[model samples]
Target: MSIEITVSELYDLKETIAAGLLEGLTYPWEALPKIHDFIIDLGESLPKDIYEERGEYIWVAKSAKVAPTACLNGPLIVDEDAEIRHCAFVRGNAIVGKGAVVGNSTELKNVILFNKVQVPHYNYVGDSILGFKAHMGAGSITSNVKSDKTLVVVKGEGISIETGLKKMGAMLGDNVEVGCNSVLNPGTVIGRNTNIYPASMVRGVIPAGSIYKKATEIAGKREGYF
Candidate 1:
């Protein structure tokens, strides 16, 4: 097995309220279909003082700042101190972790964003799971569907996993940085602390602690890089 492709390798479960849901699965994308039900069950257990049920199946932390102009759908949760900026569209089946930022015009659907993650400008993230502290630069987006609408397949060095679904987006490991205007193609898996170049079209599984220039041009990061 490629350890980097597993849920335990890509994310710190403690950083998310969805830890219980994610922990039971080997791959992060496996949690996508369960997010709706998980949020409903979890929201009922959240402390009343901190989290408020805003609408049917929607919970928002009292400390989180949500813009009045934002369009939020059900089966969603915004954790403590998070920010949902102006006109952000949350299309349901989502979790925004503590201190995370969903910036202006960003759209989310069926996603789990771990603590302190940021998709802060004009981003469209769907059917994805972002690990702790991952940041997507302006205009970066996850392309969740293949052109032919076939089942997504995860492929990487000496590893292949058949994900029996047609709509799987990128899984970004902890502290991954996606540069401006980048597009993560369907079934993409980026590893921990890796950096992606701006405007790049990325696919497949990129290893941890590397810099991606292109599919054929990847460079390992210097030792001790934070």
Candidate 2:
């Protein structure tokens, strides 16, 4: 099988607390529904000295910086040294990984952002999983629901996998960089070490280590990039 959009292919599980939850799961989106209960269970086990419970079923690392203007709901865990900027909205069932950044006016729901991921500035991410160090540029967002509201399906080259989810979002692999104002359509899977151009409307599976300029134009990274 091609190593394209599978859980193992898209993420380094060692980077998140949801590692065990993702194990044996063929697709990363499979873990979306399990995130809520998992956070509650995980929060209860965190050391009191390091993680402080804010309201019900919420754990915020002592070292994390959360702006007073930010709104954070339950079933959420903000990891060590992460930053939740002013007016950020975390709508629950979310895990913001160590050293990650949820910047000004960004909204997140039912998502897991691995270590050092950044969704800074005017981003709306829902029902998604962002791998280690993935960065979404300003004004970029994940379009989580289709206008027709049909079950989401992951479409790759010569293959299609039904996700059976009506509210799925994008899955961004490690070190992926999405340019400004881009929109990742539902069931979009961007592979590791790839770069997407600014203001692009992206969908389907983008190969690992590639540079996506447009739907018809994608090129592999330069030899020295690796």
Candidate 3:
């Protein structure tokens, strides 16, 4: 039997928790339900010299750049050097990693974005975890709910693992590049170093070091293409 992909396989736990509140969880999504509570716990521990509580359960780093037009709700942390572009809306329960970009018109909720991750356009990322350097091209978004509104199932290599949740979104691994105008369907799990072609509708699991050109066409990463 093939070993199923878990959150640890795709994300560096140390990095993801850099600004997060959860301490121990087997799956990334397991942390979702506790995000709001955890933020309240962690916000109290933030150093006053580096972090400033902007509102209820919301902490903004002293050096973070937040545009005047941006709207940030509570239970969130904007780390040092992170940029919240004009008109950005961070609903809550989000940890924007250092040097990350939450771009103009972008919306985020119940998400953890690792350092250097970029969603610098009109992106809607919710109930997800974006790994280090993972970039969502303009107009790319993660669709967290299934059309049928059933619990999500992650399938790869002919095996399916039930996630037991109805609202699980995409898990984008480190260095994953989601091309422009693409939609990552519910329970999508793209492995490390993979690239999704522009305007593609992606679902299920995309293996590591692969290029997803379409639903039927996925190619292994060429050695020299790196």
Candidate lDDT scores, in order, read 0.94, 0.94, 0.86
Best by lDDT: 1
Q: Write the per-residue lDDT of candidate 1 for residues 95-187, one digit (tens) a residue.
A: 999999999999999999999999999999999999999999999999999999999999888888999989999999999999999999999
Question: Model 1, 103: alpha-carbon shift in Å?
Answer: 0.6
Backbone clashes in model 3, listed as residue pairs = none
All candidates' TM-scores? 0.98, 0.98, 0.93
The lDDT ranking, best first, is 1, 2, 3
Which tens-of-lDDT digit does each residue in 1-226 have in candidate 3? 1132566677776665443443455556676677778777877988999999998888999999999999999889888889999999999989898889999999998888988899999999999889889999999999999989999988777768788888888888888999999999988888888999999999988888888999789998878775
The alpha-carbon RMSD values of the candidates against the true structure, listed in the order shown, are 1.4, 1.3, 2.2
Worst 10 residues of 3 by lDDT: 16-25
Q: Is 1 or 3 the stronger prediction by lDDT?
A: 1
* Candidate 2 per-residue lDDT over residues 1-226, each given as its tens digit: 1237888898999998778789999999999999999998889999999999998998999999999999999899999999999999999999999999999999999999999999989999999999999999999999999999999999989869999999999999999999999999999999999999999999999999999999999999987785
Output the lDDT of residue 114, model 1. 98
The runs of at least 3 residues in candidate 1 whose Cα sits more than 4 Å from the true structure, single-residue gaps closed, are: 1-3
Q: Which 10-residue window of candidate 1 scores lowest in summed lDDT?
A: 1-10
Q: Model 2 segments beyond 4 Å from truth? A: 1-3
| Local error of candidate 3 at residue 60 (angstroms) | 0.5
TM-score for candidate 3: 0.93
